[model samples]
Target: MTNPKSEPEMAGMETDQTITPVIMSGGAGTRLWPASQGDHPKQLLSLIGERTLIQDTALRLRGRATGFAFTDPLIVCNESQLVPIRTQLADIGQTAWFMTEPCPRNTAPCALMAALEIAGREPDALMLLAPADHYIRDEAAFHQAIGRAVPAARSGHIVTFGITPTAPETGYGYIEAAEPLDAHASRVAAFHEKPDFETARRYLASGNMFWNAGIFLCRPDVLIAEMQALREDIFKACQTTFAASPKTKDTRALDAALFAACPAQSIDYAVMEKTTKAAIVEADIGWSDIGSWRALRDLAAATDGNAVRGNVLALESKDNLIYTDGPLVAALGVDNLAIVVHEGQILVAAMDRVQDVKTIVEALKNKS
Candidate 1:
């Protein structure tokens, strides 16, 4: 593995300053099961175009020299996924400094490890923390939003990107923000979990809420301080784990022992909910978490109100969404239904009821 320190020219980063991207890529993506499996999660899936989600994230940093500055990312991924990680990065003709988790210790530990690494390079280094599997259709707008948030990060605020909600989505957490920090940013009021349909409708009507985009920008020192105050146990574990692990290509050897010792917790529960420095940026640039097969179908839908992919044969099918990479899918006179044909599994359900696919997965587990 080449030294990350030697890749200064990639981002046009200054010798005196550094900003690392921290990608959190360790979710099973259960909602997108069948296609997204435990062995190969959603981030590794090539859902959009030729590039996998992980590669798209890594390549997001590669473009014409933008004034908004950033360094190469430090990817925090699971031990079992190192091979896919390597292959994905190689496919993009880029390499990221990887810190493999010994176990699935969640985003809190992941972010903390990233902060520890970033702190070593520049004590006040900024970090762009994001998931690898999210979709943003507007890259120019995303870059513009990042430019707006950079000053907020510099001023020691943990800035989170909140998507302007297009619908009453009960699946996403909401961020209530009031008053703009500048022209484009806002001070976060609170974070709320997924609500019921009626409550989601109210949130949508209020116009003060944004879908939690799970994208954060902050300085390493500020995050360290916040984690130290809000989640000391996680902070200490991360410090110890980073100290013991060698910064090399072969990080799989120590992953199990280290992860087993660390506690599992999401960043929201571990730090964001408890931090007073929490702030949010409200923007709508066509963002989606792609949480379910339903969402994937909706995203691929054409203007005529139908989405079809793979070996799909539809007859008299209107307003139906079909996704199949395996098995010949034949749809007849179905509307508002999602059909997923893969492997030996065939999922055919009402689009509105697709969220209950997890229940079926649970029942299948019981049968095993």
Candidate 2:
């Protein structure tokens, strides 16, 4: 992987680029079952720090970086989540432009709609598409990486920030970097799907592979043109929805009929993986998607190999995550497990199988 440029190396490379952060907050987060539900997802929960994930994301974009200026974040979320999200942002003293999806249509449509909206106002401005629920420990490093990506983005290349892999993590997709675009960026060679354990090890061993962080930077016009050329159906549908949506000073409520007619697909499958203008900037920002209970456990674990929160007793338990938001949870002689108690519901699963928690949620839905 290409090494991130040092602060001095990135000095004097400043530009007048205006970056609009588009925070995607429409995920269901079913893997975090009892604590995260349809109306209240992980982004709304204060899992990592005192601030909720969406609030943290917005706070990160509050000030300007070295090379660029930031406008208020544009949040893309569902109608049901609007009030809580607004309240959370208000609690943090941050304001945003909200785009409420009428229904779930995935990231491709979301990206298209964001691009259309931003392009309408300022076509030359850059849009940083970021997930509302990711954790980045080093905010300075993240901003530096964004600075590194700015040159390529202004040149009409769609830049994706790639996390330098620290281990053989099988949870995330991988991106292979080809030749160097400059001192700080590389041409994307290929995008690989999530691999098995053995393949993950191989990717870790390969120095050129990086974890896909799912964050993108590009000019709004560039993204709009690419979507129109590559995924015309999604582009047209989102355009129709955007045009029909009623706009207020701070919110855009999409038309339900127009939005529901759009197809569901991620930006990766719809455009990013297929775009020829893809570029990668290596970022060692201590990033984590926090996709499952095991991931949260790993992030919050203490010196005793246990991550405990609320009223919980973990006796003779090593490498276990015990959390309670409702009642006292007592555990004895359990290792490599996740035990969560929230809102009168309980979950006990082996850590290795925690990724399958979404399946249990699906089963519960079927039973109802």
Candidate 3:
């Protein structure tokens, strides 16, 4: 193993300006089953590139090449993920602080807790809220998007990064960019929920819509204010949990009972949809949330039409996703399906039905 001591420190940022990266890492990742379990989620696994998804996410803002400066990340995740996340980041020589959630309360409360925590300390800090399981291929474009959003964010706009829709993707929500705030940013006209295939097609044809990338850049004050106004109950509950809980070393645990009582909602639903100050920066970066097996398969799509890993042998398979953990995955004349072999589980489902994989996890939970 190479010494992590040689890894670069957080550098290249101007002295006066700094961005605090608050990474939301609390995803169960059930759509990517067998390989992604409750204990070990997809963010910790190297599904695509050499690095784990969370590692890729962490370094997205920090780099000598991009010159994007960031403080050590404040990671919010379940307690079970701490050890693996710690070990993973250490391998890359990146140091981060962990905020452990007492229970899973979704992203709205997670974002609220982080915004409040950071606001308590640095009142004027700029925070870039990013998901831990996205894949962005273009680093330069991603950095440029952040650069464009910073000015808007500092001007008190809650700037959400929007991805230019490559296809009519029904899996993501859409943000209709109404008017240009500038050459790079736009004022959000309306936030559209996930559309059906027909609606998504119309959105793509309109040329005014962008995929809601779930990435945001805002000051702590701005975020907290929006949360308070839009979701007072969540704000109060998270505040109570924060006040009641204590920090030990680099970890802060939320009050489980208090937090569990908080309303479950996404940050988009709670704030961005209702906020008048919502702004958007168009990012052409190759981005995918990789929420399903089909998405992951598309990443490694080969000339032979197979996206495979480990000990996979496809005799005549085409347009199929075949994966193996510790066993052999053999496919013959299969097409448009996902086949996964784990230590004790074998998953085979149609590519179209891959999104329903979460039902399997739900069934297991009900049985227990």
Candidate 4:
């Protein structure tokens, strides 16, 4: 509720810059269904490597880098996820602060609530807002990217990491980089919504566009001021909910009624698109949101063009992704498909249509 304690006081941070990593872990990940469910979302799963996605995210931001010291990660998620998230973090020998949402109000309200909490404690400290489910392979490059953005962020600019697009990705939004503010950072020219195939190709060919990585860095007070100016309704609702909530030494569960009253909007729509202080830092850190089965397949594909996990036998399959946790999957001459079996559910869809997997999840929900 109130400014509890600064990072130096709470976590014993010692550096010129103290960054509190806010790991946003609230998405249900319906697009990665069967394996990724509401109660146990993709962030809790070890989809990429040995550790869970959230665990990896926490570990990625841990320890001190060259120019900054990171406090323990602050995880934000639904109340139902608190126990599991705490357990997961503990498994990695990591301690974290948590804020539990009573209901989902998307990232805008989530960011505002986190900024309010952090600003109350440390107004000068920067908050690095990142999703728990992204897959970034290059930790060194990521750290470098953060270092490049810190000066701009400290100068009162809200910086978003822009991933160098390897392909024309229609699934993610694009950021048009305007003039170079520095060698590593750029002024944002415009924010474009997800484009069609032709438009995506154009974006790729332009050489001045990058995929919106959804990772952001800014001072908590700066973010609060921007939100207050742009979305006062959301700002007031989150402030009311945050103040009304009860807090422990490390956790706060938001008031359901108040949180539900807050409008649902992403940080992009609410603040970044309209803010004059917006900046973009180029990040070639092998970032992937792992948004769908196709994305996972692309990340893990073998030279033979198949991403096979568990007991899968593909005789002549090419460009097919098969994952199983229970039984063995045997595919014969299937191409460009995703075949996944987990728990008691199975999903078989063309890789081209993997983005439509949410529709199947909705259908199943209605059937239930």
Count of backbone clashes, every candidate in sequence: 1, 0, 0, 1
Of candidate 1, the 10-residue stretch with the lowest lDDT total is 1-10
Better of 1 and 3 by lDDT: 3
**What tens digits encode model 3's per-residue C-alpha lDDT throughout 1-368?**
11111112212324445678888999989999988998789899999968999999888767433324677889999988999999999999889887998778888998988987777666556788999988999988888788878667767778999899989999999999978877777899999989999999999999889999899988877777778877888888888988987898788888788888989899988998899889999999999999999999988889987899899889877999988877777888889999998778989999999999999989988999
lDDT tens digits, residues 1-368, model 2?
Answer: 11222334433445667899999999999998888888999999989868899988998887888888889889999999999999999998998888999789999999989988887776657899999999999999999999899988877789999999999999999999999988899999999999999999999999999999999998787788888888888888888888889999889999999999999999999988899989999999999999998889999999879998899888888999888996888889879998988888999999999999999999999999
Evaluated at residue 64, the lDDT of candidate 4 is 82
Query: What tens digits encode model 1's per-residue C-alpha lDDT throughout 1-368?
Result: 11222123333543333457788888778777667776788899888777888888877755433445566677778878888898889877886777777578778888877777777765656788989898888888887777777666767678999898989999999999877777777788889999999999999999899899888988787788888887888777766767777765534233456657877898888888878778888777888888887787778777756788788888887778787887788888888887876667777788888777777777878999
The lDDT for every candidate, in the order shown, is 0.77, 0.89, 0.85, 0.90
Encode model 4's per-residue lDDT on 199-242: one tens digit a residue: 99999999999999999998887788888898899888988999
Q: Which ten residues in a row have the lowest lDDT in candidate 2?
A: 1-10
Score candidate 4 by lDDT: 0.90
Ranking of candidates on lDDT, top first: 4, 2, 3, 1
The candidate that wins on lDDT is 4
Task: Give candidate 1 misplaced runs (Cα > 4 Å).
Answer: 1-18, 63-66, 249-255
